[model samples]
Structure formats: structure tokens, C-alpha cells
Target chain A: MTALYQQSLEGLTRLRGIAGAMVVSADDGLVVAESLMEGIPGDAVAALAASLMRRMGTAVSAAGFTPPSFMHLQAARGALLVVPAGPDILLIAIGDRHINLGLARIEMLQAVEQLG
Target chain B: MRALEPWVEQPLMTFLTESEARLTLLMTSAGQVVAQHGFTRAVDIMSAAALGAAILSSTEEMARVLGVRPFRALSHQGESHGIFLSAFETPRGRWIGLVVYGQDTSLGLVRLFFDRMVDELMAGVPAEGGPKQVLAQNFESELHSSLRALFGR
Candidate 1:
């Protein structure tokens, strides 16, 4: 499982400013596996990403909309992008302020499919 | 910092009374809550207010960078429960509303009535004492007071 995740996210980190990545349990926001570098707090990102995913999932349903295939969070300093990997897991990418989400999103979807 | 006007409250109440929505809250884009319905605890409102504001802000920024339009509404559906967080503008300022519903109502219904509710809200807003352009010198204290009021702390 670790090998699979490691192989899955290796290509994603090559993108500019994406310092870290992880797979987290959407239920409790705990990390399953992570590939991280300095300056990115993986645990906090996992927690927020998991919590946000759970909320977005329900909010989508409550509004009569399709559940989002992915989520992207941007802050002044950095960004965290989340995409559903499976029913209960989320793949999170932590990037710097300049991380390009358009390309990053495409790359993450590929990583998610490859992980499957 | 401001309360939901009585005009706004009437329609919000009516919307809740008519729909199966379990809870609803009107709060600022920055997370300061104005008015709420169906919540008993301050902490719950505080949490909802904070989370709703954060989600709206993040998604709005994400849309700008991703080169897509910002999401007008967000939802999460479980087997029997759901929530909707959406943003609207009023004469006062930008506001975010979060609603909760269960099996008694459907998201389809929620979506339908929510539009009306928003329209009522937008029409009801008054052009007085709207939020300020510059942060107040005592913004910290004001914020704390507002939080205390919102959370009953």
C-alpha cells in the first residue's frame, strides 16, 4: 500500500511549488501515507482537507448538485488541493502560493487514477 | 457586527417554516454571524459561521486561480442528511448562508426554495450602516464582542 501511494504521488511533486502530498481518511482526517517536504504541515492539511471534503460532500447533496469530484483550497501563502481517491480516502496536494491549479488538477486526477 | 434586519428575518423564518430545512444562518463573508434559526447552541452557530466563511473564501480564490467561475453553492449528501452553503450579496455587504436538511426534504426542493429565499433576502436588505471600508481601530474588540454575541460566550 505504501509502495502504491509512493509511486502514485511521485509524478505530482515534480510540479512547481507543490512541496508535499498525502492520502487521508475522509472520515477522521488521518493520514494514510504522505510524501512531504519542509514548510508544509501535513497533519493540519489532512485534517482540514478531510473536514472540508465531508462538508462539501453533504453541501453538494443538500443543494441538489452532484458531489464535487475534487476540491481546491487557496490561501495567501499556499494551497491545498483535494480529490477523492476512493469512497473513504482523499488525496491532498500542498503547494506554494504560485502552484498552478489547472495543471495541478489534471496531474492529480492522473495520480488518482494511477493509484487505482 | 450587524444584525439581520426584521424584514430579512421574516422571509428566512418563512423559508424555514415552509421547507424542511432544519437550520439556517446568515453571516458575513468574514465569518461574523448576523442571524440564525433552529440552532440552540452558540458553539454550533460559531462553527457553522466560521466554516461557511472559510469555504466561500477558499472556493472563490480557487476559482480565480483555476480560471473557472466561483461555485455559487456547495453541498454534501449523505444517505439521509445534507447541507448547503451558498453566498449572496445584500445592500449591507457580502453574506454566506448555510442550511441543513434531512430526509424530510430533498436537495431539489432545497435548491428551489433557496433561490426564492435569496431573492427575498436581497430585496429586504437596507442601505444603512452597511459594513465599513476600512477596518476599525477597535476591530479586534468589536470582533470579540460579535463572537461573544454569536456564540453566547
Candidate 2:
């Protein structure tokens, strides 16, 4: 599990415009593993990103809408991309505006499936 | 259909209206029906629940540690809009969520909703002891591991 998580992070780094990546447990919203940039606060990002993921899930439920299979939070500084690896697993990516979003998403989807 | 006041109260909701507010589905955190807007009527309810469940569990856990509060996600579906917002309690599991779906829903708007919804839920509920110390410790470690993976350092 740990090795695979590490590989996922490295894969994120190899992507263009991406700042970093992390493997988080959607069940607990805690970072299981990570790969980040210099001086960047990896812990805070993971925590906050997990928090955001939870928030997105709840919002989907309350409005009488179908639950979200995955969440994609995009910001000006960069984008927070989340995908479910399995029942309790998630793959998150933080990237700059220039990142090839469609490509990154495809890569992440493939990576997450591999974890599954 | 109803007065837009309730819907307009949330910026995220409005954003969904402007966006792909044509095809979408709505639901509650507990797998109940609150509303369902536009879609092919062939939407996958299970997928929606999976998405909501993942988010709900995480936020509830975070609220416990941050000493803020808990919230739930509220969804609003439009033709092209897709939004999900969850509000939570500080330490003891009390929150709400509001999600909106549409084409014009910007990430900034979604974030704005997140900030406001947290504030709203926190204010609405009474304070409580944050997550247990032991649980917090484990969560902290988990956070570290995940972040390292995210950064790929």
C-alpha cells in the first residue's frame, strides 16, 4: 500500500503544471501518504483538502442529490483534484492553472484504478 | 419553482443555476430525497451516494479535530451545474450540506460556499470538546503521510 501510494505521488510530480499529490483516506479524510513541493505545507493542504472533500460529500447528500463519486476543487492558486481509489481510498492532486487538467484527470483516473 | 430566496441565499446555489443548470440530480447525505433537478433521468444514484458518503465522513472527522464544528452537504442540480456543500459541527458531529449543480459554477464560488458554510454551521451550534486526543494524533499522522504523497517529495 505504501509503495503504491508513493508511486502515485511521483506520477503526479511528473505531470505538467502539477505542484504535488497525496493519497488520502476518504473515510477519515486523513493523508495516508504524500509528495509535496519545497517549503509548502503538505499537512495543512491534505487536511484542508480532506475537509473540502467531506464538505462536498455532505452537500451532495443534503440537497436530495445523488452522492458525488469524486470531487474536483479548482482554485486560482491551483486546483485540488480528488478521485476515489477504492471504497476508502482517494487520490488528490494540487496543480497550477497551467496544468493540463483533462490529461491530469485521465492520469489520476488510471492511477486510482491501479490502486484498486 | 419555489421562491428563489432560499436558493439564492447561497452563492454556490446561484452559480449552479448559471452553469450547466440543465441536467443533474439531487439527494441528501443519508441517501434521502431533498430535490432532483435536470438530467437524462438515467443518472446513477449509487455513484452520487458514494461521492457524498466519502465527503461526509471526512468532514465530520475534520470538524472534530479543528474545534470548529460539523456540517453536511446540500445539493442543487441544474442543467449543467454541479455543486455540493456540507456544513459540520465543531467537535461532536452536527452539520449540514448544500450542493448545487450547473455549468457556471466556478471553483471560486464553491470555495466561497465552503468558507461560509463552515462559519454558518459553527455559529449555529454550541461548542464541544474537539476530537479525542488519541484520535487526533492518528489523524495527524495520517495527514502527514498523505501530504508527502501529494507533494511527491
Candidate 3:
């Protein structure tokens, strides 16, 4: 893998209670790199997530609300936390239903800062 | 009205009211107060209703062009977390807003509230056909076209 891919994997590895993580391009809804969940359809998840991200961003923008640099969604079945690595890149983590979302968000934020 | 029936369900309404959280629902298009339970005062419901309307109006526009459905967005402020906006489409093309708020609460409860509320909302509506067909036929193209113009997209 490329250095950027390895770096993202390393960062994702550090987060607690995350079931899987991926670096994705919200611009095209493609997965650039991922860690864990070897057999899962990581690409499809990335695409759907990126689409959701873009839709959410557009929605908030049109509402005259401040556009978010990150978006988080937690459901009864699972939780999804997305952090913007840049305008083009997003770091996404899916967690077990029991994971701590706040902690995961902070960890992802730290990773983003480090990725800079 | 079947559309308004679930709000009055005895156990379900009571569950919402007794939970250690704030809850409210609104009609997206008209921003009308649909149902509210728990500790939410009038101001809170009003604000959430407005927030929901704005978000739904914004997303409905995007969903039209993309042919994609919109989901809920959750925001957190300190220890108080609020999931203030989301869309649930009735079989007749009417959209309802479902919202819930909690303090130091579990993610489980929040999801439960959201699912239950949306399910209730959908249940009250006559399900003569499925959601996919209804959404496909009832695409809010006008909303999308207007938004694209507004946002220069």
C-alpha cells in the first residue's frame, strides 16, 4: 500500500471500539484505503457513506447553517462517525452499538490533526 | 386521521413521555407541530420544528436530483445531545419530521426513539404501497431545481 494509505490505517488502528475504518473520498464516494473487515464490502460502505455525507453537507448548507467539517450518526444497530481529512478526503469509522461516540470523535479529530 | 393516530397510542405515547429525554415531531412542509412528549417546552419544540423544516426542505431538494433518500443528522452540544432533524415519508408523499433529545443518555435509547417514532409515523399512514415506489414517483424535483439555483449547484 501507499504511504498515505498506511498512515490512515495506522491512525484507524488506534481508535477504541471501532469495528472497522476507512479513508474515503467523499468527492467520488470511493474508498482509498481501509483497515480490518477483510471480507466485507468496504467499497460499497464507503460509497454509501460518502453519498450520505455529501447529502447531509448539502442539506445543512441550504438551511443557512454552518457547514460541518464532520458528521456523526449513531443508530441502535451501530454507529458511524465521519471526519473530514480535507475537502477531498474523509475518515470514517463504524463502531459496535456499545462504543463511546464522543471518545471516537475525539480520537478521529486527533488523527485528522496528525494527518495534516 | 390515520396520519395522526400513532401520536395517541397509549403505551407508545406514554413511553415517549416518561423517558428521561426530550421528544418532538413536526410536519416538514407546513412546520406544524405533530406530537411532543417528555420535558420539551413550547420553545424547544418550536425551535426543533423549525430546524427540522429547514433541514428537510434542504434535503428534499438534493434527493430529487440524486434520486437518493435522505437520513437523519445528529448533533451534540456538551453533555446534551440532540437529534433534531430527519424525514419520514408517508405513502401519500407527505413528509414528517421526527426528533429526539437527551442528556448523558445512551446511544441505544436515542436510536430506539428515532426508530420507534418513525415507525409510528409510518404505521399511522395507510401503507397501500411500498416506500420505494412512492418516493420514486413523488420525487421533489421542484425543490431540487430551486435549491440548485439558490446554491449555484
Better of 1 and 2 by lDDT: 1
Q: After superposition, how far is residue B109 of candidate 2 from its true place, in Å?
A: 22
Best by TM-score: 1
Report the C-alpha lDDT of model 1 over B16-59, residue by residue, as the tens digit.
86556888887666555677777887667767776777788899
Give the C-alpha miss distance for residue B93 in model 3, angstroms: 42
| Candidate 2 segments exceeding 4 Å error | B1-153
All candidates: TM-score of chain A:
0.93, 0.88, 0.86
lDDT per prediction? 0.76, 0.56, 0.59
lDDT of 2 by residue, A1-116 (tens): 79988987898779998888888765444568888888656655665666676678778889988766667777777788888777766788888878888888899988887888
Highest lDDT: give the candidate number.
1
Clashing pairs in 1: A57-B76, A57-B77, A58-B75, A58-B76, A58-B77, A59-B75, A59-B76, A60-B75, A60-B76
lDDT of 1 by residue, A50-114 (tens): 76677778889999998788888889998889999988788999999999889999999998887
Report the C-alpha lDDT of model 3 over B14-113, residue by residue, as the tens digit.
3365333555454434443434454224455455555666666677778777888654544343445556455655664555545455543333344445
- In model 3, the clashing pairs are none
Docking class of 2: incorrect
Alpha-carbon DockQ of candidate 3? 0.03
